[model samples]
Target chain A: MFYRTSGQFKTSYTADMALFPVRQDAILLAIILAFAWVILPLTASEFAFQTLLIPILIYSLAAMGLNILTGYAGQLSLGTAAFMGVGAYACYKLVTIMPWMNPVVAILLSGVFSAGVGVAFGIPSLRIKGFYLAIATLAAQFFLVWLFEKWAWLYNYNASGAIQVPTLQMFGVTVAGPTASSHVQYYVVLGIVSLMTILCINLTRGTLGRTWKATRDMDIAAELIGINLMKSKLTAFAISSYIVGVSGALFVFMWRGAAEPNLFDIPLSFRILFIAIIGGLGSILGNYLGAILIVGLPVILNTLPETFGIPISSATVEHLNIMIVGALIVFFLIIEPHGLARLWALIREKLVIWPFPH
Target chain B: MDFLNSLLVQPFADMFAAPDFLMQVLWEGLVSGILYALIALGFVLIFRSSRIFNFAQGIMVVFAALTLVGFHEMGVPAWISVILSLGVMFVLAVSIERVVLRPLVGQPDIILFMATIGITLFLIGFGELIFGGENKIMITEELGIPTGEFIFEPFGGFLLLEQKDVTAVVVAAVLVIALLAFLNKTRMGRAIRALGDDHQAALSVGISLQTIWVLVWFIAGIIALVTGIAWGARAGVSFALEVIAYKALPVLMLGGLESITGAIIGGLMIGLFEKLFEIYWGQPLLGGNTETWFAFVLALFVLLFRPQGLFGERIIERV
Candidate 1:
């Protein structure tokens, strides 16, 4: 009832084909943008902006990357965290070693590195599918993490074996560093995430995206229809890894500011995969929704107990938070396997016919 | 010749030079193999019947061990604690079957796999809540499992074997025999095989899938208990044991998901190979710590050779 889209009409093809055809949606999105840009900077606490919002934006981007390969392409990849690690480490080395290079170019080049690695690992998909492919990808996850840890040259022989994000500035404005404010970091992540999200949506809706869908649905049928399985699968891997890599770069540089090999372990991969699953797999908007649930739930779970004046230990809360998230995953899968995106669509459908139960 | 003698020849020469050490390594690998086989068996049972991989089987091992130790700490008699732990596992199986599996009956394989992950998270939380997030030593002696060591002097070197290791092998052998008999000779076992062979056909034959699912999960629970006890005795009961459970994953990959004998053989091979690699090749060449990924890499090579695994049925793609 609150979501009624009644009386909204479009005449031109361009108008009809607008990202959000409804004027109300456009207005709503504009308000959201205004809040993010103007109000959030003024209102949100430093901790909230840095920890909650920035991490969510960065992880949502990574989840979006995994969604392209796993959700849309029907490949079950467990190496997302590894690919993200590749991007983060590559960006770190490139920017620090080549002091004159632009940060954005370093980040993009890091993504290219990840894309190359992703395609190499994705080659096994030609002979394997489903669980077999998932297992094969695990090799990538373990091997890459081990490489990062053992190869002292990668970390420039740091004794601690961890990477520190160098202070980066763009256009004389500090984008990342101790001097940068929480709002600046948040806005930078928000900008990159938004741009990537738009690009992802465009790519998934284009001809290449249809090829991915066809391959996912029925590879044999897709091949029968003259779709090149190798080309389509490799493209999905390359593009998906590129997105994941950029997200990883942004995550470390903009959010974490430091990282260890432990940060890119299998559990991290599982966490990203969980976000993709809980958030709808194929929908662009579901990435944000899923990220919110996966990343926000623990915070809310931790805080809600305190709000009720309960004195639960933080560890207990962490455990309970895991339980609740797990329960929700099972609940969502059972209730609607399509994930939170389908629920949104269902609500929109009902809204279109609200006030009269037809 | 010196390089080859030191690098390659010394390891094998050392093995044969000390028959006692060779026997000890074989026994240690066999014991570890039994535990790995137990975990792999739980996964195999569920996969055979439902074709759904239960990734939470590792957590269940931790949960079962934690429950036994928790009850024992509460002053329950050793025998009573054992019974109580089994009851706890049974309740967990029933609840999981009803809550997670029942609702996700017809869902896609990946979705079901994810739900098992949810089950994993829930079990982690639930286990921690009950047992606290700390390691606890297994009461192997109190539970009537042996703790003494057997020493042998062969090839002029002393070799020691834990009594618990011998006990593990015997118990695993007995359990395997019992499980094999039950699977082949029992009516329910045939029904389970039928269900695994074809779900719809079994349903048409009036086989109660819900009953079989509960039964299989219950059996898996029992397997978890034995695995927990054995593994907990070796390494204290903690979430870190879940890492060891990962070793079972490569075992499954090499053995195939649905084959019992395959799991056993694959477990033994991985156990022996990983240990040998870490001791001889990994320590000398890579400076050790290769055990973590050696099994997975081996499984990767095996998959490249035979995607169906060592004993898995030939996979015939329909389309």
Candidate 2:
């Protein structure tokens, strides 16, 4: 079999404990990166770049951030979009106040703001746990969105009460704002998402990740084992919100172009939650898979009827998309509660052992 | 110092200066509290019986009302539509238990919670597809609910109350009494409580999980219907009503997820206090519309003191 690792002998613990113990995973990732960095940019149409490539990357990053907290750390937060809004608004203010600052730098620094806010909100986690903590996060969700709406300065006192991303250039190439081409924007999102993914992989595999998993699996036992529950939980929140905030900055500045306070409402939070859960909560690769299914599925579904000449209205298609996504979530949970990542692992395991009963 | 005075003293001063307005605000809060209580009642029933936080409770309210309205639109009599809607709810309960909850048995709590959210989305799309997304008025008169005003003189000023609000209160009170009776007096009700207490113990005692789950869900459906009627009568039925479900979460937080009385009192406290705070302080000071997060902030503060909620069972962790 292509995935057979029988000949790949580990001579030492270091060799055995490498991130990619199997040779094939590295090869597969290289292929995907090639497609993302080279093939996709060259072949994809404007529509595909905008709808599929850009959104999937951004959503995957967002889901990865959420996965860090809920899936890894065990603290459930329903206020991800609000944190993202914090990132978006923070970035907006940064670029506006210091017009000379690099947009990319603003995006990275925006995460700092969201990380701070997230830690502030995460304090309640020390007091509460489970569904109670989740609901407490909603206080942040509602309150922050309210603040976004009421505080005019966040949107730069725009007449429409919405934040607009200004045109920005990097190396004499437009990278953001309405005038920017999808091609440049897609590359920016792609680069950030890839960087975040690598960061998440190492973070989740290291001490912080283990601490989060320990905290998530059982806080009391983790504490008994000498883990600082407060530090572990707050750090999880900070890291998770930082990544989510950057994705949010990218979400609005690169993809959305403009955003109203309503964009950061509960539905958006649920949508990101859907991506994280459906992607396979604890798995890194599941974020991309979940984002593909959640973000890419609707576009495909919308186009399928038209391609087949079904003559259905767009409204019906939209409704059907919602129903299908909802049903798919339930279906995925019932069939494989660990999510798409586990499903892939199962498939890979089978592939590794094909034609052998044992 | 001025900011602190406005924050603390001005609200009280405003209330004293306009006692009639204060009475009106309190009355409004009480009515909304009843509605919130009704919705929280649905959540409590489902959560207690099956340990699933039924996010669909809010949509079920809209779905039930829509079905009744849809039936009436189809030329069915109001009373017949009511009966028919109940039948639909029963079918929904049974189908959900059979299709969604059956295979999902023994799953993690988070998974089950997500499944209910799935149900919410399904119901939203399904409801909208059938009934269209436009807002529909509840046939308040056809349903034979009073729709008038009752004014009184209090604090040497005129205080106004809606007759519909009075009816909502009366109906909610009766429903609570009847529900309490059913839980205390009926065999099925006792079985539901048994399941809530311990599933394995209840199963060992010959209680049927599927039957009790369906029954609890059906009761939740019934409560949804009542709530839909009450709230719809106030502000027409629409998908927008679904946001009220979020309101009930803070109620569950403050009241305890499993405590019915907690839901009631918590609902009343939130509804009243949010209103009082909004009218006196929020509108003048914070630009109004504070109802969204007031309940949640209050609940979070309360949770800081009582992690298990106001009346939730005490948590005892074991290693």
Candidate 3:
């Protein structure tokens, strides 16, 4: 069998609860990491970096942030994009005000601003739950977007009402702005995403993670068991927003290079939510898988006509692509409501028991 | 001190100084409120029946409007096109029940909600593909609705009202009356209420979930069509109408999710308050377009005080 574990007996609790309890799982991760870091960067073209690698990573991070709230902490927020806007705007202000500050550090620190906003909006969450809470988060969404438009100071009183990324360098090689190469941006994105993802895994596996799970299952029950609903919900909001904010900053800085207020609107929030849910709500790895499918879908749709010598207008392709995505969401929900992560778990289970009638 | 004076006194002074303008703003608010109520009714219907928050309701409004306009463009008579639009909505309801809702039964509410969003996206793509992305004119003249404005003179000032706006208000009033009558008098309607009240108990009494779900969705579709026409008359039929449908969510929050009366009253209240705020406070003081988040913020504060909404049943959480 591919995943044979005949002699992999654990002698201690630590061994039993290791990050990768199975030897094969660790090896598989190592192989995946090797491909991501060493192989993909060297092999990928600028188009691939922009269209696939960088976007998938950034979206995965964003989805992870949402997953922590909706999936782990059981708070549904429809306003993720606004928080992202907060991070992007905050980062813009930080770098502009203190030109000597490092771009990477500025991006990392931008999350704090969103965390504050997230906590402020999350106050209503202490009183509201379920669909009502979803609508409450939308209050945050609309108000923040309005703020973005009205509060001229957020965009620095620019006539255009858009933020443009200035050329930023780390050790004289530009890492952001038009002059920066996709490869450098990709590396910066990959490094941050990987580090944050590792941290998320550990956090979700720790005491706070269990507390969140308890709260998610039933807040009343969690409260009975001495878990402070306020703290748990608020922390989930803060951490989730923090991670989401960093991803948002990276989204504009490392990927988009320029952004308007509406760039982080509801549609973008929904797209991130799609990634998180389709990726497998509470699973870290699901974000990457979900992002790949969602991001890759459009590219594949655009190319199919050319690959097969078919004649189709780009507009028609766009319409069809939307239809397919909509249909795909329904199709996936029907096939596996638990999401792609659960599907992967099922597949892995099957793989483990292959060649035998267990 | 100056900022406080303008914030508190100036807007009220402006409203009193232009009483005619005040009447116009209130009238505008009432028309938009009726439209918001109509869309929220669509949401309330689906949510009551299946506990699925139909995010597609907005797109449904757009689709219904587009279908009507599309049919009229194809040489179909206006009234016939209206009937055809109803037929399309029925098919949409049936297919949604069969393909989407049936398989999604017993899932979490959030999952069901997500499925409806998927349905919304699909319908958007499909509608855009068939109708194209251009804004089409609603055949107001062909429908026999008047196009002239009615002016009333009182206190040496004139209040101008578009005939179409009057037609929309009258028709909406009639539709709500009919809807209320239908819900109260019909056998199928009672089944829907029963299902909403207790799912298992209703089934045990031989209520057919499939039939009831299709009926609710179709009724929601009907509401969507009516809303589309009313709104299309004012703003023209386009996908941009979908954004206005989002206004219904706050109405739903303010009125209780299941209370039909709540939806109507909440819709009207939000409509009035948002308009008044935008004109008096939001425009002169805060720069305009406060209508967008005004309803949501108002609903949020209301929720902090009354979580179940003004008319919604108190939530009884059992842990």
lDDT of 1: 0.87
Candidate 3 docking band: high
Report the lDDT tens digits of candidate 3 across residue range A109-155: 99999999999999999998889999999988999988988899988
Identify the superior model by DockQ, candidate 2 or candidate 3.
3
Every candidate's DockQ is 0.70, 0.85, 0.86
TM-score of every model versus the real structure:
0.95, 0.99, 0.99
Reference-based lDDT, each prediction: 0.87, 0.93, 0.92
Give the residue spans of candidate 3 off by over 4 A. Answer: none
Q: What's the best-to-worst order under DockQ?
A: 3, 2, 1
Native-contact fraction for each model?
A: 0.68, 0.74, 0.76
Worst 10 residues of 1 chain A by lDDT: A1-10
* DockQ category of candidate 1: medium
| Clash list (residue pairs), candidate 2 | none
Output the worst ten-in-a-row residue range by lDDT, candidate 3 chain B: B152-161
